[model samples]
Target: MSQSNLFIVMSIIAVISSQPVRGKDCVCELQNSESAFPESKLSRVEITALECIRNISSEKMTEVDRLVLGLQHRLQQLNENVSMLEKEDNGNLYGAVSLRIIQLELAEIQDLLDKLGTTNTNNQQLSTEMADQLRDMKYTIAELENFDHTMVVLKDQENQRIKRHLKLCEEELNATSPPPTPTMGNCGLGQMVNVSGAKTYSLTVYGTSYSFGAWGRDANPVPGDENKYWLVVLSSSNVFGHFVRQYNSLSTILLGIGPTDTHISSSNPTTNTIQGPNMVMYENALYYNCYNTLNVCKFNMTTRTVTNVALPNDAGFNNKFPFAHLASAYSHTDMDFAADESGVYVIYATTSNFGNVVISKVETSTPPVLSQTWSTTLHKKTVTNTFMVCGVLYATRYLDKDTEEIFYSFDTKTNTERYDWRIHIKKLQTNIKFLNYDPRDHLLYVYSDAYILTYEIMFR
Candidate 1:
């Protein structure tokens, strides 16, 4: 590539670095079968697969992810639909539509009669066809993976070429472009000569403490909600704080939308009508806890109607054994719930006679019914706490010269039933009056008395 072309690529890299919160495609190189993830057992080909992933563009990698999600959802729907045909033989209206597609219904009554002594529809035919369709789906999935790898390689080449050109152009502009001209509502943008920048738009969702500057008492809403995905703002009073909940129709959250305490009046529905409003947009339906009851539910944003999922009995909606008064008995510091890449977990204080601390987790995967509860007193500081990005948990507690608590990492993997312990404790920044986990990046952020302490986590 020309010297100018190389500079262009470097400028693009600078832009990528500017959005540091996005860790996707952060690895510059690929991993493969030979060099697969730090797994105990790996095929030789895994290194190449890792290499392919490392070499690709972040954009393409996300695209493939979206496609796979779409595919999985479609497959799930198909399976659910197919399962509905179960009661067809009885010919009841409950499954009337489904019955027509039932195994025996697929053939003529006369053909069924002539079949054999035991007309147990071999379905060997359908099985064969099912196998074929499965193969096709597998093929499509593989194609998507290959396409992701190919795109990554291509983008790297394009970026390397574009960087050289960008750098040269940037230098020339610095030397020749007229000094920046200031404009309204612009923050430091006019200072950058010719590199155009967009005006940052500020959308206030909630109020901050400075507004109420009303001293004596400040309350931060309890923010252990991984399912609802919330921002927990600590109050000036230190004892009281409430979480401001918002609707996240899209799984992805925007970055740098500074904390807002303004109340969001959702037009969708009332809280009393539904259980705990832990709203999560699942493809189409909005899944949540009904009035914070054991009955997990779903609401369609389009229809604004609650949906009843066919889950196990343990997912019952009532004053069940577990939730009858779990909150009341637990420390009053309202629990924060979070759903990682795996199932949902409750972050709360397991108030035993012993000193109260912060820690909670999910022991099972199925909905409505959880098999176990993992609780531990991770820190001695027991004032207030919340989970931030990059899987780090932060808390605020009394600080004695002899003892102080800061931040820690609990678990790393996405899905796990067994509590294979992986906890890291490192004494960190004090005076973090407030802390919030930004979904945009995996950074444990804290608002100390002064500037923001952005803790960059290094994952193994």
Candidate 2:
């Protein structure tokens, strides 16, 4: 054979002989999930990662299948349980969210997993072929004692091909992967309070684009007299806590997203703990509304952590069910809450017992741990939520006599007494849209898609 042809024959033999007999590293043992080598460049190590990523994808696919199976099994058992409930018991929101929301999420996950399974298998096959090709190339490069003209040209072409294939595989992997969708509620977002009586900072949360649409650090009365601010949100579905100033202008999120208390189950369940990124900071402590359970946890910013502050009022709360969600638009009858040196006051929802505008209060002063004062029925047509700015409660509630228009500020201090007199306050904004308290600025910020309005306290 010609000299060049003879070299090719020898290289092929060498490539074939180097195939492992045993005792090689098990690719599965060196898993990808251990730690990521994000900036690696070594071709062999990259190939190992490619292999490991495929395995990880396979494992995820298996998990997806398992979840799907569990969903199906749960659905069947739930049906049986439901039938028994109709016969001797009742139904609740446990399965309401499970059936409508959770099942749909499971199906979506399954679909992604199925696609990942197929893609992973294809990538695996492609990687194996590439590895074999690399082995052959190594053999071809063997015995390079001298510069051979044709062989140099062939190596250059092979290298170009390898680079192109590598790029294509990476693009494919990138294109098929899913992006994370963070579920951030308007936890401490919508409510307005001039935190710590400051005009430069706000105790607000960063909400998502789909929700409050505009997400940013809101202003609150910047902490003075050694107090702090916080932006609260639930962590990974199971955690509840707020973000606060760690040092200087830097911020850090604290609290493991755990249950409101022992009443919540160990099984991590999906939920909406806040309407927006809403949180309340007071007395060097942090309080949050588990909304549904109305569960509050007191956190110390100095210690950088929290402790469950179960008030006597919420002591009987089961934590088994979720609180009802407030709508996105303007509804006058929707009452929220705000707390100050006086007490914590909750605006009323149009519950049957509360009539229409239910203004409730819990005094922080010594005694029966926050009384449910004034559960009187609302005579109004429709009302939204409530928020307090400088001890004055602002409720966007429907006019009792005029349902067509939504009015602002059903002040507990003012509205608790005279009905006709308090409802006549000059309308803050005619078409009152979304409202939030900028505590740092002590201004009521109202926004719609088209308008951003700020109201300064003239008399508070």
Leading candidate by lDDT: 2
lDDT (10s digit) by residue, model 2, range 33-113: 223333333455456556656654644534434444434443543464344334432256234533453455456546655
TM-score of each: 0.28, 0.34
| Index of the highest-TM-score prediction | 2
Superpose all Cα atoms of candidate 1 onto the true structure and report the RMSD in Å to 1 decimal: 29.1
Q: Which stretches of candidate 1 lie over 4 Å from their true place?
A: 1-206, 209-332, 339-343, 352-372, 379-383, 388-405, 409-440, 444-460
CA lDDT, every prediction?
0.34, 0.39
How well does model 1 score by local distance difference test? 0.34
How good is model 1 by TM-score? 0.28
RMSD of each: 29.1, 26.5
**How many clashing pairs per prediction, in order?**
68, 55
lDDT, candidate 1, 1-460, per-residue tens: 3346567767777887887765467434322323223232223235444554554445433333333433343344345446534423444543544434333333432342344312223434534655665565566545444434337766887899999999999898778767665231122111111100111111113343321101100111123322232332323232223223342211111222223233222422334233221223332333334443443444443355554433233332232211112112112223343433333344433335133333334333223334335434452323334442223333333233222233333333221122222323222333333333333233343333322333322222
